[model samples]
Target: MVDRLGPRYASTLGWLFATMVSMLFVYRPPLSLLMLFLWKVVGLLPRAVPPVVIARKYRDARASVLSAFNAALTLISLAGPTIIGIVASTDPALPSILRATTLLIPIVII
Candidate 1:
């Protein structure tokens, strides 16, 4: 897939796929289960593509780019749930937390 699509497009597609799937979590229907199932099938691309994209995109600054990427991932893993939890408490709605989480998605996408 990466060979045909290229790292940039493949990674973008992965992120877009993730965004669409994550939004479905708010729905909580029989369809949501289908979406979750689809995600489990395709989620590997995003995890595998990003490092290749970062490596190619920042060829000269690979070390710093990786460091920054790792740092951001660390921050997201720690902070994402916390932000979602706080918003979920005040509003008790999925959309509210989705909105908050969407703010961070762009950071990773860029």
Candidate 2:
């Protein structure tokens, strides 16, 4: 969905999400389960690259692109537990803001 939206709009959405999330820390607003789930959904959005977009983007080298993508996903899967463990170890009481920040890292990079 985000890839289909293209880079500009995708960036807009990311900024909007960041702004809303930062407000939680700034204002200390009451958090809801739905909002937390939405944050996760947003964080996961960048990982969902549509096949059509991938096909179009790498028309000349689809196989190579796909292989690289697959490798990256594998690396991420392998590293995720390590990354989470390190982050979680830093503070036993990992706050929601920190959790959300960790989740949003990929989206921000995208």
Candidate 3:
């Protein structure tokens, strides 16, 4: 797919699909296990394409950029739950906010 469409389009579509999966999670459709399964399958590309793109684009600085990327991921993973907990405790609209944010953030980022 990347070979055919090139990395830019491929990554954009991959992320759009990911954003769709996130929306499905928010909306709670039927047969969601199927969506989840397909998401996991398709999610591989979004996880992988960036580093591979970075590797190709920044041959010399690939390690540094990838390391920084991984570090940011780690920090998000560590901080996300604590922040969620704090917000969930104080905010009555926490679920709504989570749903909106989850849906909106990826779209904006994409």
TM-score per model over all chains: 0.29, 0.25, 0.29
Model 3 alpha-carbon drift over 4 Å, by segment: 29-110
The lDDT ranking, best first, is: 2, 3, 1
lDDT of 3 at 5: 83
Tens digits of lDDT, candidate 2, 2-110: 6698655564455445545543443343334654454444444344798676555545354454456556555545444444433433442445555566556544433
Error of 3 at 101 (Å): 12
Q: What is the lDDT of residue 49 in candidate 2?
A: 94
Each prediction's number of clashing residue pairs: 0, 0, 0
Residues 15-67, model 1: lDDT tens digits: 44655554444332223354445444443345546786745544545445445
**lDDT for each residue of candidate 3 in 40-69, tens digit (9 for 90 to 100):** 444344454678674454443544544565
Best by lDDT: 2
RMSD of 1: 20.6
